[model samples]
Target: MPVIDITSDPEALTMTVVAEFDAPVERLWSVYTDPRQLERFWGPPGWPATFALFQLSVGGRALYAMNGPRGEVARGAWEFLAIEEPNRFEVLDTFVNEDGSAIDGMPTMRMTFGFEEAGAGSRMRCVSHFTSAEALEQVIAMGSIEGTRLAMGQLDRVLHDLREYSQGQGTQTEVLSDTQVRITRLVDGPRDLVWRAHTEPELMKKWLLGPDGWTMTECEMPDAAPGPYRYAWAPVDGGEGEPFGFDGEVTLMDAPRRMVSTEHMTGTEYPPTLNDLQLYEEDGATLITMIIMYPDAATRDMVLATGMTDGMEASYARLERELLAV
Candidate 1:
C-alpha cells in the first residue's frame, strides 16, 4: 500500500498531504477531473459527497455538497484557476451554504494538486493555503485533518477497482465449466502496449511476479509461433523454500489479438494447463480474456484451492501500473 502523509501548520496557514499510488499518473488524475469518481471518496466516513456541477477548465466551476449525520449538509464550491493534464492544477475553494450561495466572511482556500512520475508508480502532493492563521486554525479544529485522512484512505480501494474496470478486467470469478475457469479484465491504453506487456520477456519480468521477494530471473519466448517458452523464478534472498518455474509451448499465436499456450508450474505434480487468450479493442481500450482449461474437475479445483486468484489479482494490479506508465 502507498503511504499517505498529512501535515498542517496554523502559523504557515497551509495544510499539505502527500501520498504515492501503484497506478499511472493519468489514471490518478481522473479522480480529480472526473466528478463521478471524485464523489465516491471526497468526504469522510459517513459524510458522502455529491457533485452537482463540475467543469475541468480554467475559470470553470465545481459545486458540491457533503451529507452529514442528522440530515445536515455542507456545501462548497471551487473555481479552477489552472488546468494541466496528468500533472497539476489549482483551484480557489469557498465554503458555501446549501442554496449555492457563499457564506459571508467564511474562510476560503487556494488549493494546488501536483502529480508526478515516481519510478513505476505516481506521487500526489496537495497543498491547501488559507487566507489567515485564524482561518487555518478554524478549519483544522473542524476535523479537516482526520476527515481528509479518512477520505484518502478510501481513495486507494477506489483506484484499485477503477483500474481493474478500466482494463476490462472483471473483479468477480466465473466458473465457466467443470474443467475450465475464465478471468477477464479491461485494460486502458493501446493494443501494442498490452500485447507487449503480456508477451515480451523484459516487460513480463516487471509485472508477472506473484508477490514480494520473488523475481523472474529467466524468461524466454523466442517466437510467438508454436514452440517453446520458459520462465524461471526464485526468491531474491535465496531463501529456504523450493524455487518456482514454468515452461510451455505456444499452441497458437496472433499478434495483438489471440494466443493459445500450455503452461505448468514446476515443483508440483499438477498437470499442464491449457490457456487461451483473446483480446478485443474499442475506443483506445482493450479487453483481455483468459480461459484456463484443466484435464479434470479435480485438477481445476486443486489449482483454485491454492489461492491462485489472489495472486492473479495482485499481478494484474501491477500490470495496470505498468501499462499506464507506458
Candidate 2:
C-alpha cells in the first residue's frame, strides 16, 4: 500500500486524504475521468457506485448513485469547477435525491484533487471543504473516513491489476547481444515529458530510486555537449556504512528523441556501461526503447547477477507513475 496519510481538520471544515499509487497520474486520474473505471472503486466495500452522466471539464456534471447493502440507492452529483488535466481539479459535490435534485439543507462539499510525484510513484491529495463545522461533522458522522479508506483500498487493487495487465500487454524485453539487453514499453504520456523525466534531476529522483528506504541524495545534469552527470544514493535507515552512488556522462542527446550515456557505479568492479534510449510517438503514446550494453559478456553477467534488471523494472514502473503528472 502506498498510502501514507489521511487527516482531517474539523475547525477548518476540511477533510484531506492522501494516497500514493504505482501508476502514472493519468492512470489514477482516470478513476474520475473515465466513467466506466470510476464505477469500479467509487464506493465503500459492498456498495458499488454507478454513474449516469460523467464528464471531465469545467462546468461539466457527474450524476451517480451508490447502491447500499439492502439495495437502497444514494444518489449524488458533482459540478466541476476547474480542471487541469492529469494534475488537479476542483468540483462541487452534493447529495441528491432519486429525482436528481439536490437535497434541501444538505451539506454541499467543495472538493479538490491534486497529483504530484512522490518517491517512485505519484501522491494524490483529496481535500473536501464543507460550508460549516456542523456540515463537516455531519459527513464525518456519516462514516466518510472509513468509507474513503475502503474506496482507496479498492483503488490500490485497481492500480495493481492495471499494472499487471499493462506489463503483460505493453512491455517487452529481450537480449540483443552477448553484451546488451533491450527494453521497450509504450509509455502513456507525451515524449517531451518522458525526456524531461530522464534529464531533469528534480524529476529523476522522484522515480529513479529503486525501492523504499533508498534515497537519491545527489543528482546533477549539466547542459552541455557530452553532458557530465552524477547520482548518489544513501539508505534512509541511517545504517553506518558508505553510501552507494554512481556518475556518468551523456554521450548523446537529441531532445525528445534519443539520448546515450556512459555510466559507472561506485562499488562495482564491472567496467562502465553504455546506455542508449530512444523515444517516439506511436498511436498517441510514446514508445520508449532502452539498450544497455556492457563491456563484455562476463561483465554483463556479473551485473545481471546483482538483480539489476529487477531494480530497473521497479524504477521504470515508478517512472510510469510519475509521468502521469507530467
Candidate 3:
C-alpha cells in the first residue's frame, strides 16, 4: 500500500492524500506524465483506465475513461493548471459525459500533485480543493478515498520492471479485500499467444488442466460477449477425483488485453464470482492479472481453501512448458 494517510478538512474545503514510493522523484513523475504508464494504475483493480487524449502542458486537457468489469464506464477530464517539471503539477479534475462535456450537478475539484525526494525514494502529496464542504463530502461519500488508495497500491508494479517484479513468482494470490482476491502469474510468452491459450479451446486444452493425470474433457468457448462458456476436467486412468466443470458468461472482452466474466460451478447453486482478467506484455513475456470478486467473505475463504492457487500454478507452469516452449 503506497498511500500513507488521507485527511479531509471541511473548513479548508480540501482532501489530501500522502503516499510514499520506493522510486525516485523523476521516476515517480514520469509515471504520472506518461499516458501508457498512467493507465496501468490510474484506476483501482478491476476498473482499468484508458486515456483517449493526454496533452501535458499548462491549459491543455487530458481525457480518459475508467472501464468497469461489467462494461460500465466513467469518463473524466483533466485540465492542466500548472506544471513544474519533476516537482509538481496542478489540474482541474471533472467528471464528464461520453462527449467530454462536464456532467450536470457533478462537482469539479482542483488538484495539486507534489513530488519530493525522500530518504531513499520519493513522496507524493496530493491535495484536492473543493468549492464547498458539501462538495467535499459528496466526493468522499462516493468512495474517492478508498478508490485513490487502491489505485496507488498498483503503482509498484508500474515503477518496477515486470520480469524483475514477477518472474519466478509462480501464481501469486493476494487478498485485496474481504470479498476480492487478486491473482497474478508471469508467463514466458507473448500476450497474443497467452490470450489465445485462454480463449481458444484447442490451445486452452493444451495447458488449462490443473495438474498431471487430469484431462480437459470439455471446453466450450464463447465467441463474443454475453455468450456462455464452459470448461470441464476429468481424472485420467480412473483417478480418484470426480469430474467437475465451471460455466460462465463472458460479460466484457477487449481482445488481447482484457476480459470480464461471471463464473459459477456447474451443477451447483453457489453464487457466481466476477472475474476480471488483464494481460500486459513486456520484454517478450506476459503478465496475467486476474481479480475475482466473491459474493461474500465466507465464499472467498471457501474458494481459497480449495487449493486454487496451487492448481493455477500447476496450470501456468504447464502452459509455459507444453505450449509456450513448444
Q: Highest TM-score among the candidates is held by which one?
A: 3
Ranking by TM-score: 3, 1, 2
Error of 1 at 24 (Å): 0.8
lDDT of 2: 0.77
Top lDDT: which candidate number? 3
Compared with the true structure, what per-residue lDDT tens digits does model 3 show for residues 114-148?
99999999999999999998899999998889899
Q: Note the clash tally of each candidate.
A: 6, 3, 0
Work out how many backbone clashes candidate 1 has. 6
lDDT for 62 in candidate 2 is 92
What TM-score against the true fold does each predicted structure earn? 0.50, 0.50, 0.99
By lDDT, rank the candidates, best first.
3, 1, 2
Better of 1 and 3 by TM-score: 3
lDDT of 1 by residue, 1-326 (tens): 24478898878889999989888899899987899789867976445688999988999999999865224688999999999887999999999987778899789899999999988989999999998998988888888877787577657655765444454433345565577676666666677788888789889999888766778888998575778898888888886556778888887677887677889886667689888776656667666667687898989988889777777777777887865556
**Cand. 2 TM to true fold:** 0.50
The sequence of per-residue lDDT tens digits that candidate 2 reaches over residues 151-211 is 6765764555533434334446566457766666666777888888889999999988876
CA lDDT of every candidate: 0.78, 0.77, 0.95
